[model samples]
Target: MVSASSSTSSGVLDGFKLVRILDQDPKHKSANLLGEFASTANDGSASIDQAVLILEKTHFSEQFYRQLEDPNRAPTSDGERTIKAPKLDAEAAVLDGTERDAVFAAVSNLGQNDVYTWLLAWLQRSASDPGDADVKMTLIRPATQTHIDKYSAQRRVMVYETPEMYARKVQPWIASFPPSRIQWVYNILEHKKEADSILFEHPDTESGFIIVPDLKWDQKTTSSLYIQAIVHNRELTSLRDLTKDHIGMLQNIKDQASRVAFERYGLAGVQEGKPDGNVRCFLHYHPSYYHLHVHILAASFTSHPGAVVGQAHLLDDVMDLLRLGVDMKQRTLGYSLGTNSKLWSVLYPDGNPST
Candidate 1:
């Protein structure tokens, strides 16, 4: 039970008591909390019975280095890792040897990452809930028809892309995304971000992949659990690049993904093991981003967008197609793309396609 009366000075959350956590996004430091509040019978005195409280960490401490010589407050001395501060002018930030003791005192402590994690814990912590203007109703789940209409969700159509078509259409269209649009995917594969979340990884460059939880999942419920296996090969982007020669790499990734799923998440129907758990793994076409990745979602997510016909191709089917001498590059591969997308425009220039 969590009470806000003691911690709140404005009395806005004076009677609110936390009941449970509905959802959370650890990367963003935000959570959707289900709570209950007391109410009175009086017309104007009555309060809401139940409320969903959304708490989010506003931002990270980016200017922690400036903590030093911040006149109003003395320099921090939490421990090493803090950045050394310098007085700045129009041209340069000067560090005077005369202030050695002060500079050393500040540099010798924690700041940057710590300010967002621990230092504030031992010092000062604050929360601000400004009400109506500050809160947006983002907790609505099981996206309804009205929500889809209000938001104008993009409806996609299936397009069968061939090698000749890829050269004339997809390749030229996707060129705009490399090293920029999907830079974060590279950061993950290179261990720059979410390195700790990698479940399994292959050291082989050609067949290598790392499995990580999909942000759509809460990482708690096994029924709706979702994960992704991102390929280590930076140059190989999608099914359009696959050939009979890449069968071994595809098989290796699938084998490892199955291994991790069987060992980690039970109720798994892995052929090598129990053959019991219902873990469905497939690869999306026109894949989420411009990188090669496999979507491994729980069997329960039948309504998943990727579950739609022609949207996702099963890993097993893909590998078998390769084994059967089907050339993915030359084969007419069907996939969904938004109507107004550049690829769509290129594929169906005049809104009429060739049979």
Candidate 2:
């Protein structure tokens, strides 16, 4: 009798039945196949399912050595019959490839798992402030502690403060925007996807064109999520041209935009309307980091060319824009954005906004 056993509990052939090829020929290929399977059955890496499938499809020829005694030939029962069991080699039945490749492919088929893996890696990187040199230096911390100490001392002497310290100092700049603007910028920064720098051209040849990373969660909806907006590229244009005399103008418009967006959607919910030919919409996805976001893009917006152009967009672009505006204002005023104005102060300084 020939039987097959699996080496690993998870292998395909773990509990599969092994069929025996019956034959009497000692030199036949079937005998060799059986020997091969028996010899390598405990290798622990071969897939059991594949081996069983191969065995089931294998065929062998068997010759009968004896027949029942005929009545006419009575009493001459000296003929002997022999039986042989040859196990077929599983290799002949299964596809040819490395076992490691097969298992790796199976595990990678999970899409959500892949997404989470990338998201976690990105979050870990972003957790450190972009301005932090220590965080960047940590990238090469494997050198001796003495080397690290020298590097740290040089950086401290050359630069007034660490990257983290700089970030803290500049945070007030972000906080100066109105509450609504601050929230908007925060949403965008948190959700916006980053991509390696790439060469991009403006569709209209307009100078305002700046290449920002394309952000969209799903490719199918990319056309709807992308918008043709102002970008910040110092080389392409002066800071004045980008932020320009619009500091006060942007602030005023931002207030109006926030009030309109909040009143219309935050209170009444998203309704059908043309936000400059782009349908204004609200979406809620349970699986995303930011569950609620308002989606807007011009109806005519097209894709940008880049290796990572079609990546997912954070749902909170509008919020990001507002927050960025607030940050800019804070930088200009040199003050924190979050502090609430006292009632008496508000009356004396600017009067009740409604009044």
Candidate No. with top lDDT: 1
Q: What's the TM-score of every candidate structure?
A: 0.56, 0.20
Off by over 4 Å in 1: 1-136, 139-150, 270-277, 350-355
For model 2, residues 148-227, the per-residue Cα lDDT tens digits are 23322121111122234324543333334355533433333333433232123233222222223225523234343332
Clash totals for all candidate models: 4, 22
Q: How many times do residue backbones clash in model 2?
A: 22
- Model 1: weakest 10-residue lDDT segment is 114-123
RMSD of model 2 against the true structure: 26.3
